[model samples]
Target: MQTFTSYDGTTIAYRVWEAPADAPTVVLHHGFASSATGNWVVTGVVDALTAAGRRVVAIDARGHGDSQKHHDPAYYGEDAMARDLVGLFDLLGLDRVDLVGYSMGGVVALVTAAAGRRVRRLVVGGIGASAAEQGGVDRNSLVGAALIEALLTDDPSSISDERALGFRMFAEATGADRKSLAAQARASRHTPIGLARIKVPALVLAGVDDWLATRPHVLSSALPDGRCKVLAGDHLTVVRNPEFAAAIVAFLAD
Candidate 1:
């Protein structure tokens, strides 16, 4: 568990699995409320990337995993997350990398790519362009609030929404810091952005049934060099799919 200090003095944690020195390195960003281990390592993403002869650098976003956790909403934003990645790259001396991000991490990747970071290839999953355009309370804010309420009150009965309740339960089950996650949710909002600045080849992938990331083709079309692909299962299950790993390996290899 390697650690680096972000520009804002936030401690960030990351793990590097080395491959051949000449092989292209891939940096992975996990979804909302998930750690690098939960989203990438445990899901076999690290193994697949390593097996394909690629070096892997997996990050635990602020307020998730072993990284520094903050309950202040000021600590999180799409730009903040992007800055964290940039700091990680600078700390590790990574000149360029293939960036793979899922869900909330996908938004961070887009922000980073748009900011002219050294991303050679971008693979975004469980998100769409509409997400990049929309501005409002995110889908997870309610869940975060519910989790916060439950955590503060120590009573699950306070949450009314079933989806929010489930999220709270999952967070509790996973031993997550509910306050920090809730703060993250409150701070994160998808603001409209132009994708024309991103010149790298990108692969937009998601589950066919993922309503949260509707119309991935729209996102792909926005990119100068982008394409979309759908796999079986919903957003949650698709991460466990072997095809997901295979597609990424093939795309990067190409």
Candidate 2:
């Protein structure tokens, strides 16, 4: 594990594995409430990529995992996380890297790649037209408030929304900081995402049964060089599937 100071002086945590001299490096950013271990390492993504002769870099986003926990909403968001990624590249003197992200991490990668940073390739999953329509799950409004309540409230039964309840249960099971998660919900973006700006080759992946990633073709059509691939499973189970890593290995090998 390694740590770097982000733009706001918040400490960001990451892990890296080296590959052969000629192989490409891949960066993995996890989803909300998931750490690097839970998202990529335990899911067999790191092993798959490393076995394919590719270097891997996985991060534990601020307010999650081993990273700094900031209770302020201002400290968390895709924009901030994107900047942290670009900064990581700069600090490491990396020219470019193949980036992969899931769920909330997907939004961060999209925003970073769209800005024309040092990203060579992109693969974002657990998202779909929501990326084009609502900037990839913009719960910044009432829906976001509900989610915040789900994260902060003392009583679990108070959360009426099934998805919100799921998030709460997942957070508790993971032993995550609920207050920080509430701040993250409070900071959800309300603006639209400019998908057309990303010029690099991109794979907009989604699980066939994922409700959050419906009609991924729309997301693919929106990007300059994007294609959609749907695999078996839903949002939670997709990353654990062997085909998921296989798809990413094949895409980055291109």
Candidate 3:
């Protein structure tokens, strides 16, 4: 695992799987409560991309994996993680590359694209337009609070929401930092104002059963060069599907 310092000097963990000289590089951002390895590596995404003749740069977002975990909500924001990505590129002297983001990572990538970063192509998976507006998931809500409580306690009966319970279980099973994830709930909220500003080719991907995500077509229609693709699974299952990586490889390959 390689490390890089972000704008705030927060240490971020990343790994690079190099492809052939002519192959393009693709940076990957995992979803909330997921690490780089858990998202891309274990899901067979890294191997798929690498086999497809593309270099893979997978980053563990702050508070998610081996990276620095800050309990302070001030350390996180809608664009803070995006800034980390930009800083990562700066540190590596990489001017441009293909980018793929899932769930929370998708939000960061969208914000990065809105910032006019040098992303060659973008594949946003497991997220949609609601992330840019107000109707998306709320971290401080009753359900979120319940999830945290479940994660902190041994008694699992208190978590009524199945999704929240699933998250708590995943976090515990993965030994993820619960407090840092709580802070992430407060920090990650995107409010994209100018969709037309992002002129790069983008694929807005979602699962057919992912009701958690907002309308993917809306997001695609808003962007200057955006299109929608739906996979066959829900939010949690979609990332693990080989089709997810296949869609990304196809889009970036073009």
Candidate 4:
């Protein structure tokens, strides 16, 4: 329940779990419409990393989770969100850190890592570089946004039962308004910039059945030193798969 002030004076909240002072630090960014706890902590990802002797820093991005939310849609841009991470590192006195970002958080990680050498290593799952190169608004993002709007309006019948349930789970975890979340998703979405600048080791992972980020798009040649791996399930389930965690642990350890 620790809080740090972003550059714009917005209070950002993060939970820190550690094994020792010298343990490698891994900062996790949850997906769009999800909080740090719901997306990772409750999923046992943070616990796994901690048990493996890695320090974990999980943050609730602005307008998501326990952090302060702004009504301005412009504030949700990826560059601004990436800047918030840089501010968090400065506030905590961390020189550099490894990053694990899922879904929308993956976009922020790509932006942050591309900005400079702040990241030691990066693992991006449940997302791809298509949005980063294709101006962010893809068919999937548009569909995802429309579904969120329907849920926010309490029109559950507008979406499939399973899809509605998924949105409900995310809503409960992040406390983000459906319309606002969708607007943010549309606004913050963009292609990854400064890709040629990233020199750190990177692992780009996607679920075999993930509708949001498909296989060929994620495995494209744009990413510098980027490597891709496919997991066994869809978005949410793949994040918790044993093989997924093993891949991350092995990459970070290397």
Question: By lDDT, who's the top model here?
Answer: 2
Give the alpha carbon lDDT tens digit for every residue of 122-225 in model 2: 99998888788888663422277678889999999889988888889999988999999888877766467788889999998888988778888888889999
- lDDT of candidates 1 onward, in order: 0.82, 0.87, 0.81, 0.75
Which 10 consecutive residues of model 4 have the lowest summed lDDT? 135-144
TM-score of each: 0.92, 0.96, 0.92, 0.88
Looking at model 1, which ten-residue stretch has the lowest summed lDDT?
135-144
Task: Tell me which residue pairs clash in candidate 1.
Answer: none
User: What residue pairs clash in candidate 2, if any at all?
Assistant: none
User: What lDDT score is found at residue 62 in candidate 4?
Assistant: 84
Q: Cα deviation of 171 in candidate 4 (Å)?
A: 2.1
lDDT per residue as tens, model 4, 131-235 = 456634244543655555654666555565465457665675556766556556557655547666777888888888887677524433456777888888787
- Candidate 3 positional error at 144, Å: 4.4
Error of 3 at 175 (Å): 1.6
Deviating ranges (above 4 Å) for candidate 3:
135-154
